[model samples]
Target: MSVLVEVCIDSIESLPIAEKAGAGRIELCSSLATGGLTASAGYMKQAARISGIPVYGIIRPREGDFLYNSDDVEIMLADIHTAKQAGLNGVVIGALKADGRIDETVVADMVKAASGMGMTFHRAIDHCSAPFDALEFLMSHGVERVLTSGLAKRADEGIGTLKEMVAFTQGRLSIMPGAGVSPDNAKRIIEQTGVTEIHLSGKTVRNSLMSYRNEKATMGSGDSDFAITVTNPETIAQTIAAIRA
Candidate 1:
């Protein structure tokens, strides 16, 4: 089967580049430089309007930890509701217990709440106390897929575990690898893991030259120059080609 390239995008402005490059789908989020956060409804709608490919909204409220409070969970639920109403194809989300166990109750609720919408258990699966158990739990909960890095720092480092997880999943669930997954490494990972779906942010970050007239600038670690953009056609094409190769 051909590789499923899901480009992680921050805004609608990045659409043309992704589409022109032949992407099959998109993972919508903002501030990817900080892991990822939920994008605004207006942004989601605009993206859905322009991107012909299936767009999946990410449900992360913030970066840092996976354990979310009740309010955070409520916020995620509302975002999911809004995302579905916006005609988006699906959502990527994950929640974990303080002890690193799968929050079955929350996960089940989320699965039920997203009954009609496609739901993917996000990278939190990688943080589970038990990967195999979490996989079984996710399958039983009606999750469409689980994005993971085999509980390793990077996909390359976790390739073996990913392959094992794929075998454990059989045909029941989609075990997708993300984080440091590249054209140079995708083929080997896929070949070993036998996973059909792949996710990536096939773009590079360059400092925006446009100076901000509205906001004041401060000297800190966070700045546009320090920021990175995602729209590297060459890298994306190379990665896609490598996967196809």
Candidate 2:
């Protein structure tokens, strides 16, 4: 079978674009600017209503490190419940201990709460002290897949670790390489890592339509405060083709 392309989208407007571009799955989120956080309830419901492919809502409760507190766990569980109620097919989750290990108790609670729904342990594994051990822990906990950059800044930069992760899984779980994936290197990453699934936003900047120039105030941290990020159909399609080639 050909590799599956999972487009990570931050808005409902990008949903149809990703689907029409031949995305096999969607990782729904908000604030892609901040590496994606939990998508709003309204967004989740609308995506589930309109999307033809599987939609997995991200369950991250906040930004910053994956080391979550009890309160964060509470919020995550509630978000997972919201995703299910919104009719999403699955939820993506990740949490870690201060020691850079998987938070087994919290993860187990999440897995139990997400019963009957697909679960992807997000790149939090990359933050672990032992990624392989973390993978085994997640597999034992019944997570279906993992999204990671192999503990590096980008997937392509970590091909060796990615290869080892794929070999280690042995079909007990799925390892997906994400982060800085592009059409130019999509085929190389897949061929080198043996991953069956890949994730990317395929986003491009669209300057705000507002003609008024607000030079003084900036709403966000970066220099592109006036620019909007949206999924590019051509980029997604090209990535699919590259992987399938």
Candidate 3:
């Protein structure tokens, strides 16, 4: 079977582009500048309405560390409910303890909240001390898939660990290699790691259309100043073609 390509999109505008590019699925979220936060209910609804493929809503309340507080858990649970109500096919979630282990309590609650929807544990597993243990934990908790870079900052650098993760899982759950995935490397990554699924942003920098430019002023604290990154359909198509080839 060909590898499944999933694009991480921050806006609903990317939905049609991704679908047109033959993306098998999409991970929907907001605040991509902060590494993606939970998307709003309005966005989720619009995404589901417009997307032809499955839309998995990301349930992250914020960026930075995956270790979430009680309030964060509450917000994530609420977001999961929102995703389900908005008719999303699944939800991507992750929570880690301060000690770099899966926060079983909070994760279980989120899983319960996502009872009938497809559930994927996000890259928070990369923050865990033991990838094997984390994989087992997620499997035991009924997670359908895991989006990870094999505990490394980038999937290409973590091919060894990713292969190990795929071998260890033994098909109990999917091991999806993500982060820095590109058309140039998708095939090699899939072959090396034996991962059936891959995730990428498939984005390119787009300059703002405003004619009046303010060189001194900035929008958000992050890199949201002038150029915004948007999904490139051609890039997504190339990635899919590479993986299929």
Candidate 4:
């Protein structure tokens, strides 16, 4: 069986690189520099129009919090409701309580909302009070996968526990380790965790050095563009090669 390399695409431009580099799946979002936010239906449709592979939506209303307010929850519901219609293959979401626990009630509603589509628990699982508890809950909730750094800043730091989680999960759930997986260590993580899927950006930042004179309209306080990061095609090929090796 092949280990799926899930590439996170930040723009229409990056999608072709991901498709060409032998990635099995993609998580499409806007402004991944801001830890990712939901891509619009128009963007989602455009992506779906281009590639035949599955594109999972990052169903976050905004950056900064894994927990959502009532209105934000409604927004997530709406996003999920329309995502498949926009031709997306799945929806990614996570919401937590202030007490560092899975917001069970909210998550349950989300699960129901995303019933027909593929569902993944986003890295919000990283902030959960108890890892196994939250994991089992997601499994029971029928979440297809959990995209995480194993509750750590990077997968290397969480490798030990990620192994434990993989053992606990057996084959019931997909434990996808993301954030910092690269060509060099991608093989090591798989050898260690024996997981079937890994997520990657294989990306490098590309921003204009030229400053804009219109300081009043600059989102970055005079920066020219919204700051773009492109997927490294060589990194993608190298990561898959390592996984196969």
Clashes of each: 1, 0, 0, 0
**lDDT per model vs. reference:** 0.82, 0.92, 0.89, 0.87
**Which residue window of length 10 is worst by lDDT in model 1?**
212-221
Candidate 2 per-residue lDDT, tens place, 106-206, comes to 99999999999999999898889988888999889889899999889999998999999999999889999999999999899988888899999999878
Model 3 lDDT per residue over 124-226, tens place: 8888877788889899989999998877889998999999999999999999999999999999999998899999999877888888887687766745577
TM-score for each model: 0.93, 0.96, 0.95, 0.93
Any residue pairs clashing in model 3, and if so which? none
Q: Over 4 Å off in model 1, which ranges? A: 207-216, 225-228
**Angstrom error at residue 72, model 3:** 1.0
- Which lDDT value does model 4 have at 115? 82
Clashes by residue pair, model 4:
none
lDDT of 4 by residue, 1-245 (tens): 57999999888888888989998898999988788899988899998888868889889999897878999999999998878788888999899999889998999998998888899898998888887898999999999999988888998678987888899988889999998999888889888988889998898767646665554465663354545678878899999998888
Off by over 4 Å in 2: 211-215
What ranges in model 3 sit over 4 Å off? Answer: 211-215, 222-226
Better of 1 and 4 by lDDT: 4
In model 4, which regions exceed 4 Å deviation? 206-217, 221-227
